[model samples]
Target: MTAPGNQAVTMNSQGTAMSAGPQPAASAGSLRSALRLWRLLRVRDAGRSDPQRLTGVLAVVAFAVTTAVLLLVLGGFGAFQQRAEAGGPYSDEGFYVVLAGTASVLLLVPLITLGGAAARLSMARRDERLAALRLAGATTSQVSVMTVLDATVQALAGAFIGTAGVFALIPLVLPVTFQNRPFTYAELVPEWWVFALTVTGVALVSMLSAGASLRKVAITPLGVAARHTPNPLHWSRVVPLVLFAACFAVLVHYGLAGIVVLVAVLAGGFALLNLLGPWVMSLVGRLSARRARSVGTLIAARRIIDDPRGAWRSVGGVALCTFIAGLTAAAAMFDSVGSDDPIVADLSTGGLLTLTIAGLLAAVSTGVMQAGGIIDQRTQYRALHLAGTDLTVMHAARLRQTAIPLLAAVLIATAAALVFMLPALGFGLLSSVPLLIQFLLSVVAVCLLVLAGNLASARVVRTVLA
Candidate 1:
């Protein structure tokens, strides 16, 4: 922010901007400048409401979950790679290593999504802070730096907590054996540089996510006041997914020709599901809103239609995990192959592990997202509560919001997994009793995990409304 015409702006050492009549502004884009601005803003927010404080707390917890899971996933990958290269009699020829890599790849999307969500958790508060900084004669660069710095500090705090969490988690994992050998803490821990890298990566992710939001919000005070409707999701979002599906079918028709192409297509197809998710969610919301016969469903559908991107973010992890579970749910059919190889048995273990962790990630991420949503809409909720509407209806609405998209996402993902795998595994596997049991258990566990995540926010809802 700069002086225009006769007005003046200056800051005391305490960081409060003063009407000191024309004076020089603080240097912009410096770390010191950003910290000073942060302090000034923090002071202004010192008297924040409980809901505001809880929002910050929830964001930090989300960051901690993200960091801890990241460390575990990377550590697990390193352990398998190290064990696979040891040239021992216990080696299954890098089989477990491949499984670990698959799990890591599958977990990366949700982990990063959680990180971004945590960074931008306090959206409404942040916009006000940004506007306040601009009013305080801070430049855009200074405001941007402060935003990133604020997110980085929170992530750093969470990273430390997450590091401590890893130690506790290692003991729990120690009891579970892979290849008849339980993991020592030493085996599960990554190298020191791994921790350093994880911290740096998290900071970078937070910064980038913050930066992206900065672009969306204008820096001017009036800009903050302006309300712009979110643009409707374009049909272009579905083009890539449709094309990918077409290519997949073409290959499937040719008796699965071009094995390398098949592998690439399969990987690309899974990626497209994520691309297609929000669009499908928006479509679901639009349709459901029209057909909604009850207040709960109507409100839930409207919320999704309002922010389909967010709607997907809350449940997207489960949708993807559900997709993975759908494919692996039929793993029991492999046991009937009657092979002497221990590798066959390990498949079930690996699938269960992947589904379990995925569920946990989805649960925590959903909880954090829902808590944040409650804080964001606290104003509306309070108004409604005062108007004699029951909070139970609101709670039911939120549950529907999560449940409906979850059903759509699961259906889309399951159909995709079945179609892709059907060429190789055939319809016979779907009919196998053991396969049905394992897959059903996997799906139920994930749904239960996500339901648990959604429920985690119920406490937050109560707090906000109260």
Candidate 2:
């Protein structure tokens, strides 16, 4: 019916048309596949912007710092030991290293973890990003879990890095040899179990420290911003303080208390700062507000009352740091005043008082630094002023609020000494004053350092506020 050439051309044209028509559908299918891949990758990207990032970053940095400190401590001790065996002039130098290193490590870890947790909570309370998580259907528990997880991951990584770094750096700092040959640095190669335990312990502490803040998130008024408004300090601080006071009283009366008694007393004092410090600030805040001629003081007072927890938290850090420094100073003083000295012999005591004070103070210093964030929250305070608070009154409220924690910490340190020494040493308590005095001076020095840090923080905040 048709010529062969025409038929062939017709068939070829039909095939070309069919292929072209399906090309668009194929391309669209490919596009959809690409889009699916992107969607799948989104989960991975989501974690980067999480509130937990702060915790993670902190953990990493802390790990590095801890590792460095550990290395310095170990290396110093090892070299001291080596030098002593060589009949060097500093034969007893190894003792200092052991005392300092053990004290530094044992005291530092818990304090750092506690402080880090408190600071992180403060940040979360202030940050809108955390609020956004809530809006996105994340429950308080989910947020808290994520935070802990991030801390855990970072802590684990950090511990590993820190241990390895310490092992590596120790050799550089102090070349300890064995039998005229360098000791093989094995077994000390970043113990996985140590990293696991350290990181886990730190994360748990941090999470627990954040408990109050997390509760706030869970119970925050619906539709209100998750930003904490001024409120009474949480009651967790009060009960513990009461219990501590009771234990301390018992210790004072008994004069034969053990380590358990000392721990209870110290913990109670720490609790009192959180509980009583906030109440004191709230009272001052109210008084200041009443006397205000303008709205600024009232607003500031309101802010102080509204966020008593924050103030208490910051004080905790200060207290902890002061306590640690005081302890360190006390120990050094004791060492300086040799036990065999006639004056020391007349005192009728051993190393227990000095060591106890140092250890307790170290714990207190950790708590105080956690509360340092309050000083960093000046902008938020400024916002209160802008919202109609008088600057002078507000500043007073802030100052008073801050003073409560510092004072509490100092008092607690004194109380800790009283409770522990009175029981353990009896009449020997009188002899403790000289060492306690040294501790007080040390605390003052550390407070000066904290104030300097605060001033620097204020300057930065002022610039940012401006």
Candidate 3:
């Protein structure tokens, strides 16, 4: 309960002096101590450690991207609402409202996932220092609180930058017309409360993710270590896929009964893809390893086989984005049919917009996850370099690790999406050159974006090895 200045040499709130006899400290008292410790080490750690600096930069960048995108998506909601109000209760503005809502739902999960990736990366980069505190007598809750506090600060900075990002992006988007007219900046802006809520949500997700990650690890005097192996992923993951297929079939068998049903099916199916992704990843890894012809491929395959969940985590956003592309590209294809209706014309623009935004989400999150993966295995990478492993081979292995799951996930998701749409579009859907072009363009763009993400982390490998 005493102030930090009371002791000859002040210790943290826990009174844990790293001595054999350490006194217990209250949680509230730990805040000053944690802040003091953080300030003392921040400069030294940033200056001395490559990973420390990189983690901070990545965390801020990720939070900023997440926030900016959240605002952009929310703007669509607000724009549609404003348009609806201007129509005096008798316009097809409601139709656009439904489209905007659906697109927002598709993008929301990936945005939060990106924030978690940022938190996970930032939290991990500090494990050594945190474990040192644990050794010096900090309790689990204390270390966790410190971790959350660290993430909260990073999140706040990121959100501020992200708001700025939205302003910066507004001019670029101003030329794009919806409802036959371009949007003013004011029209694109959401309600004032939306900004506050989004910033708070981003911070909360970061803190929660950082605190939760600590629970999975055992930080002791010895080192930062994970506990026993997690229970293996179960076959029950397939349940989602089955449920998705059944729902899709029902929507197809019946008719265009309701917008609510369509959104529910789409959202449910998207959620299920995440569950099915890891299991599918494991299956792909096992099969590819058996047929591997090169050392790089074998290593990559082995990695996926060992931790398929982590493998999926790296590429899940990209896969989900691909599904979005598959679902929306049909609307764009309809434009090629030369429909005169303004709504039909707008569908093309909306579809392309959805694909572009989803692609951005995939790219940013993939880069962060890839960087974090490399940092997590820096020691292993160093050992491989020290051994006879060639630089080319290491690079090859890293590329293969991402390339394999990304290819499988995209192809399967696209195929599933196309199949679900068959009840509506029929064989014509598959045969349309415009749809084919849209899909191909999306695939190429996604591949390029994913490759860019992988390339961004290539420097991180060298940093880790050094």
Candidate 4:
């Protein structure tokens, strides 16, 4: 209100000052500070939009509910010991250790892989930024360390959290008083050396996982032009395909017997998802176009099918984790009925039920991510709207794309179970209350995952369309 002349003069002076100054240095410094702050913020936001966190929480809860699972594993070992003392048929300490050791190793590897995989995925998403650092004269080692630090920190945090949970639950899981017999809590505590080794292992795993993504950053073309472009994974297809073929062949040759076959199957499944997901998506995309009755439905379907490989590895890994947990639970139920030991039977059944439920919750993360990806592709849906497509039909089509792969995964898990456990526990799988509960719970889990994914996607679309 004072004077238009004064305002004009002030604006001109500021414009001239900004133009005349050495601006690049200031701009670069400001950007560097901002980027640093953003990374710190991201590190702090661990598990905020994460599926792994959800899964871990559910796993811990399962552990809490089925304290008998822990007791049973230990008790089973003790039973083996007692039988050996009495010269019973199932009295082999070496056998118990072999079984327990194998299970423990299987559990440890995937968990370690999870730490690395999460880091790699995050780094992949931020590849452009990393490439910039490389172009700015950053050494490969420096860039790798900087990019992987976030993952290392997260892995350390997870390890600490897990260790804390164990310590906290020890007393609750193993009570001091049982039938008036005083028990020492020291026995319940995890050995200090073992706990220390575990934390170290977790940290190392996280670092290694994050380190894997550095190859893309260090090797990719760098500089200003690299900004805002998709990071190229030159051999992503070939390497994964080869691994998939090799692993699958090994697994099949092994005939799905014992833990070795199980491990092979898992590795093969992961590789296959990585290799074949893109091809599946392409096929789905083509089919969707041919089946399109309405414009919106066609577009949504095509969009989902076109990117099947986009998040396939993550989804596959999540599905694999759930499958293993579910199978373990189902096996425990079988053990419950067949075992001569009453305590083993009771604990196995309880653990089986709890783990099955927990596995479902863990799977929700991947489902949510799939839904999120569809929501992000809103421009395609909007274009369909312009072409006179129905929104509801489009939404349903998107959901169908997600459901197809999950259905396949479920079938594979079921088949693995039939082949592996059926021979050991005859007729247990046919009619068992625990198995029924586990299957029902898995269904509930999948429904919940779908609902979550849909809701998340819908919310994204609404916001963008608005």
Candidate 5:
């Protein structure tokens, strides 16, 4: 019944169906394309055309170096704690070491915040490239994968550099004694597994952060072109502040039994501050915007109101440093009176070390955040420059943006430190001029350091303009 040609066509169709059953050729092509994409990402030219990409890489490197240093410092503290726990001449100091370790660990927040800022800044800069990729037929998953891979590469490079930094720092750290004994190089240097873990941790953090940043844009390619306005902060933000106050009250009521409790409470309080800071900043911004008497002030206030979270990220670390400085000052006064106590002397030293480390890290964080901000806003900055806006005015606005929040942070942290210290030291402790001066000088120094860091970004602005 069928024509001869029809039979030939039926046989061809059956062969075609058999050949299409497994799709081996299509799968292999996909695998090959993925490999090619990976190779392209590994190529230097992939990042060379984009200056922001280079800046992001540098930020990651800086973050890794700082993280490595922090981990080493923490390792040294752990060694001291271990020695104290062994029950010898240092047994009395074990609690102090434990407290110090906890404080050091708490410092990780600023570092993590700085890393997040960097990742966000990096993502902001890549919006155009991402959109282009999407337009060119890359699926959202492909774009997300590419971003994560980019972050992972940068993080891996940074971690390796950071490891070298750790080795270099060990010699410098070996001479510093804690608990009446210098740390052995071995004690300061973490184990091989720890180093490996650090590298892995950094890479994972970078990958997750980059991936999270893409969530806003990955679903809809057009989302990359649209800016989402952050909602106004609500009353719920006050809960953290209230919780912190309660914790402090409990500690004040318990007194000496509260030292161990105080450490945990202090950590919680700082974390709460992180939550409350942006809200407070938003409130301040609104107030300042209403009272603004100049163009610079108006611009700065509006900027803060628009992005309070970003503003806080640049100064939160300094606020913590200010608190540490205040606490150290109070501790030093106690040490002066209790000269006979070796434990008090050791605490004073540890507190000063903590202040120094915190301040240094804060300075670095401020600088990195500021620079990243400049890079992220370069287009606007350039447009403003072309519009004949005075560079000095822009500079002043930038300073004001940092200054308002920073002043508030220092005041809040210092007040809180005083309140906490008052239960331990009577009102008479406030009359210690030497300790007060020392604290004031330390706070001023840290603020100046942060200011310098922020100002350093002006160079980036200039570079961008050129």
Candidate 6:
């Protein structure tokens, strides 16, 4: 009986030990998860603490807010269209509202591009920290998650602020009349779900862009340590331009069915331009490289040839603005052919406002991107400075880099606009002084704004080197 009792005691002790061992393992896992969360929070806190990183966040936020505001305005125009279709006072000219709404939607292109630029800028600033994180045993996936989290946070904050901005703008927008009628706040304000969707969309875009930008660093952790040269652009990019031309020819021969077709063509043309713009820059760079007489010009040309996409990203908004100006000018000329319809006047005003917003956003994006490039290349800049290279030469190279692509964008956009418009507006429209003045002024204003923005980044270079 004593032996049997000892055996039972031994069995119970073994069972208890096994149960206690599993509990500690479970506790260890939970602790690990908690620690990960803590580390993520710390990483985010560190980003916030750095001024350059914080600026990047702010830029993302500002872009998000701007996008949200534009979306809200689009919703308002949509609402106006619906009301007009319901036999509101401007029922005869309801299509104007629709056109305006379409223009507003198209404006999203620049906003999206601006957001992307800001995200890339942010990531560029964080490259070293990300490399450090990788060296410290953080997995690639973990670093990516952290980047997405940072972007999502900034986007969410921007969305919230943008929502508030919409509300704030309501009073200001109320006084502005379209077709001589005021817009009620209810008509201008979007539904809560729309705002929710806007926030979600912005967050998703930001996260995706941030993640995409990290692909290089994620693949080769060492890639973050140095910049890699981009691959040469192929000739295939010309396909879009050819396709657009063919489509435009067909549309013109048959005549556009309605405003819808016109809008579709315009939008499609712009999309093709987006694809072709970089390729064109590449060609320009190559040609400039061949003829480059000075070191600054050669450096600028080579830089653009190497990364035409980057160069285009900085000036793409200006190109879009140029297109808008051309279209608006042609419309103004067409409207002048007859009586100055209040609806036409209103449409012109809306177009001008859209162009202005686009130009401003372009300026901001250019400044942000330029500043980011300066930050990313600070070491190289310092080395160059130490090697007796005049900083002024570098500045000149940057200016030339910007100017060449910019000139190409403006010329292409203007030519495309005239091609599309001349078919509908007739050649007589070209002689309209008011139309010419408006168009030229729009181009000049946008150019000045872009230059100013680029100049602003020069101070950033000085600060970084200091």
TM-score of each: 0.90, 0.54, 0.90, 0.56, 0.87, 0.84
Please list the residue runs of candidate 2 whose C-alpha ends up more than 4 Å from where it truly belongs after superposition: 1-127, 133-192, 203-256, 259-303, 317-338, 341-404, 423-437
Is 1 or 2 the stronger prediction by lDDT? 1
Error of 1 at 400 (Å): 1.2
Model 3 bad stretches (over 4 Å): 1-17, 27-29, 47-50, 88-90, 127-129, 217-228
- What local distance difference test score does each model get? 0.75, 0.45, 0.76, 0.46, 0.71, 0.72
Write model 6 residue lDDT over 1-466, tens digit each, in one string: 2211111100122222111111121243434432454354445544322446546555655655565566666666766776777785667667766676677766876787787776676676556665554444444444555566667777787777777777776776577677678778788877777777887777787788777766766666577766667677788988878878777777777866477877777678778788888888999999999999998899889888878998998899998999889877866765676855777777676787778778988888787777777776677677878988898998998788788888898998888877777776678767788988999999999999988888878876676667
How well does candidate 5 score on lDDT at residue 171? 80
Question: Residue 312 of candidate 5: its Cα lDDT?
Answer: 85
Which RMSD values do the candidates have, in order?
3.2, 13.8, 4.0, 10.3, 7.9, 9.3
Q: How close is candidate 2 to the true structure, as a TM-score?
A: 0.54
Model 3 lDDT per residue over 234-336, tens place: 7899876887687777767787537788888778877787788888999999999999999999999998988788788777777767777766677777766
Over the full model, what C-alpha lDDT does candidate 3 score relative to the true structure?
0.76
Q: After superposition, how far is residue 63 of candidate 2 from its true place, in Å?
A: 6.6
| Model 5: lowest-lDDT 10 consecutive positions | 3-12
Candidate 3 all-Cα RMSD: 4.0
Best by TM-score: 3
Which model scores highest in lDDT? 3
Clashing pairs for predicted structure model 6, backbone only: none
Candidate 2, 1-466: lDDT as tens digits? 3311111110122222111111122244434432333233223333422323333344465544454444444444454355456664334544434443444444443355343643353344333433444443333334454444444555556556765666665454224332233434442233445445554565555555445455555455243363435445444655666666576667667764554444444554555544566665556556766876655445545655665555454444455545454445444555566654332331122123223333333333333333334333545655765877554554455444445445655676555545444454454435667766766666665555544433333332233234
The sequence of per-residue lDDT tens digits that candidate 5 reaches over residues 1-466 is 3221111100122222111121222244434443445345345323433455547665675657665765676677667766777778667756767766766766776667766665565767666555544444444444555677667777788778877787777786677666677778777767677778777877777778777766655565566766566788886987867776766767577754356676777777788788888888898899989999987888889988998998888889888888788778877887887587767777777778777777877777787777777777778778889999899988888888888889878987887777667766667757889988998999999999889888877777776676
The TM-score-based order of candidates, best leading, equals: 3, 1, 5, 6, 4, 2
Candidates 1 and 3 compared: the better one by lDDT is: 3
lDDT of 1 at 26: 44
